[model samples]
Target: MCSGADEKGGEQVAGRAGGMAALPAGLAAAPGNAAEARARYFNSANAFNIHLDPVPAHIFTAPAAAALGPEGAVTGYFLCDQSARLGCPWPATTPFMLARYARIAPGARLAADFAASGSIWYVIAGKGRVYGAGAGAGAGAGAGAGAGAGAGAGAGAGAGAGADAGVAEESALAWSRGDVFYLPAGASMLHADGPDAAVLWLVTDEPLLAYHGLRSARPDDAAVHFKAGDIAAEIERIHRSVPDAGTSGLAVVFSSEAMQARRNLMPALTLSLNTLPPGCAQSPHRHNSAALTLIVAGADCHSRVDGETCAWSDWATLVTPAGAPHSHHNEGPRRADFLIVQDGGLYYEARTMGFEFLGG
Candidate 1:
């Protein structure tokens, strides 16, 4: 008999009389037993098994419209959140990632002070400048005072500001439409929109950190910027160099000097610019990491995710659940381009990526 079960005699008598239909509750959880009242028990058949709600493969169009629409006056963010379906307390687009669209009004500044290990940003429309204080710059940098002191004084400079902004420009990255950049954790950035309003798509690992009850520490690397023209050139180079039959897709992965070894954008995330030529489709495949993709440029394009067709809309964000068979298709005469961010870095580090192609 367990210490808390004073009524074990009755249970014993019942057990001796006939077989019980169900397993009994923990003996320590008896009505009057205070010492082990909190104890809970489960058998081998059910102890390690759990069934939580699955992350839905969905498209986020409304949030994209709110940010890219020309009517908004105030600066704000529209989150592609599915936390309710995911059974998570914090906002999330996927179980491990959170995605959002940021609209910055003309001359306004957006302070990015997220509690995330890292963030990736794509300039959807308009022009602007981003001033990122290196890791551990503290509150002053985030508030647009100390760190931005070197990043020119105002947002009106736009693209012209990059050439003449002087040494102070080194601390800032001037961006226009189609540019992309990454910011490290434990740091903050002040996004100052130029003369016109700007829309940006951003994704971060905040949900992963929240799940582990951990905060990001000082990052070792600084921010890295990717010019739209440079990225396009690289993709063109890949297209010219690799034979169509030799590759899975015409894609280019974004990486920095420090992260070259792992070929990822951050410790937990990977960013790639994928393209599909006219009237072509990618091979169906699956991986362990879920993908959050931004439709950069495509018409008459769609993705087949686990047999469900997800159509592409301009500036829309799409969610691809982990381990789902998926492929991209372009039925139009023009080429299609998309930017994908995934939790593949974590999977690669854990040696559980489990990537494979599914034959049609």
Candidate 2:
């Protein structure tokens, strides 16, 4: 009798602590005998397959192959439907909508506009500067009740405190490669390209606002831009802090929602950078939150979600559905770096998320 249970390869980690998981709905979860149930469901050839509901996560690769706009940018898309059960048209959903891989011509700027929903933009390559002011929201596409609206007003007010106070009515922030910028709702901004063409990756939470009441969401929103630092520091920190018995990689969470005291930029979404050493991999694990992973630096790794595998490369994106166990292996010589943006904040706040470690 092969009761295929008691398998161990890696441990679990998440915003919350790990514990026994609830059976995947309809299935009988063995409270005292997880091993027996695991054998029946995970290993046996004759085991029944009860599919997971829906996971929220999407990945895009080779976004440059997407149709180009007249300005030459590839506005490719990667969509995430929060629970896989709800759409953005409903106020209850957190829709990540109208994503784009913007390619701005050298010295060209995306016309200044405003938006009702807050958004995030990441500089993929080249150089650029962001120009905006708290006052611009009233004139551009920014207005109405939306996420991060209050934060924009606070930033504008704070800027007015400098010695150039009287003249500090508006401002512009310059950014280069590897910067992750956020625009709070109810603000205006223009993307000015630098000497070289810039490829920008953008993410927005507009659909949820539209579904609730405001449907005319636009591109320009408000939020703080987080410039990505050298990855070596983060990797070193991981080696010094994290033990070797868990997930095989190192990661740092860059979350605006976490630093809520200083007028946090994002309300729900959080962005993180992760790295896997050469010839290493992260042990597989599952949590209730979904992840949007973009392979920004290295292509030596491929990702596995549940049983499916994607042969990914530089600029490849993957969406991890909520509750699906997954992992990434660095098959190349160099380190594999990637960006993971997720809605784990909400799950953590609601106390509905659970994490578990499954063997890779």
Candidate 3:
């Protein structure tokens, strides 16, 4: 369960679960569907270097979808879809996972929604009040909260002094830009947008349900209210505590207090922030899970996925297929940051979160 050492002299060593990952033998035989197993994992024998081929994959960056409700007031952007011919095995056999960007109309609230997949939401802009009432396996994310299966009520559960002050089995927190939260599947959520509308990117694990023919549970809704307030403040904390924490710029992780967070590999998924110092490269590393990264800050950053390289601007998104060797480099003078949402926890709980690190 050991994770690769961080450049910060292990200060950033992330805990690991499960054991090393390996392709199972006879997965094509009894008790296993080779296709389903393949959809969940990649062959380690294949080279991990993946590239975006000239530009960042555009198929995932389509413009936001508008008119999300009967009121025709809500706007949303779905970053990743099941239609892309990106050689991804997801959304077909497992959950149809996708990252989303959305703009809620001012003063309007999304109708109540519930799905069987956990969701993660980050308040990238504007302010709004969120409310959701649920117990057991949910809480703290837009309109609803819970601990979920593998984890318990998280998101707002734990906070350092002045970090997120309070979080419980209630989703009645006022949120602004920078607050990130989690929503467990099956938890009902409803949100009223601020007077100025709210912009956010959401990540979810719904494809699995769809793959299983549970299409009726999916619906459009919102994400979180535990505002982080200042991105710089969190970045500053990382720099002060571990200057040169290896891998280009600095990075930080967002996690919940309960043993089971609805939005992690344990229950489903999780989020992290990666900041590359201007014009630096992060160490090359690969894990057993795929990642969906949203460009949150800086610009003109190119990611090298195995042999393919793709460039994207601020607010764009990139993907790293499970087990694909990938790395990021800041192509501009300003610091570049990204929000990394991944399903690594799935491998973690299954004891197969194997990973390897190459020098930066």
Q: Please give the CA lDDT of all the candidate structures.
A: 0.77, 0.53, 0.55
lDDT of 2 at 202: 62
Candidate 1 lDDT, 1-360, residue by residue in tens? 542233745355334624332444445735566657767666543554568899899999998877767654556667899999999988889988998887777766665656687789999888876665452223224323221111211233122222212324455678888888887764344455656788889899888988998877864667788999999899989888856553668899999898999999889999999999999999999999999999999999999998899999998999999999999999999999999999999999999999898878
TM-score of each: 0.82, 0.63, 0.63
> How should the candidates be ordered by lDDT, best one leading?
1, 3, 2
Question: Per-residue lDDT for 105-135 in model 2, tens only?
Answer: 6654442222434567777777755544332
RMSD vs true structure, all candidates: 7.1, 14.6, 14.7
Clashing pairs in 1: none
Give per-candidate clash totals: 0, 18, 41
Q: Write the per-residue lDDT of candidate 3 for residues 234-341, one digit (tens) a residue.
A: 778887775643444466666655423444422556677888888788778888777888777767778888768877655666777777778888878888878888
Model 3 C-alpha lDDT versus the unseen true structure: 0.55
| Most accurate candidate by lDDT | 1
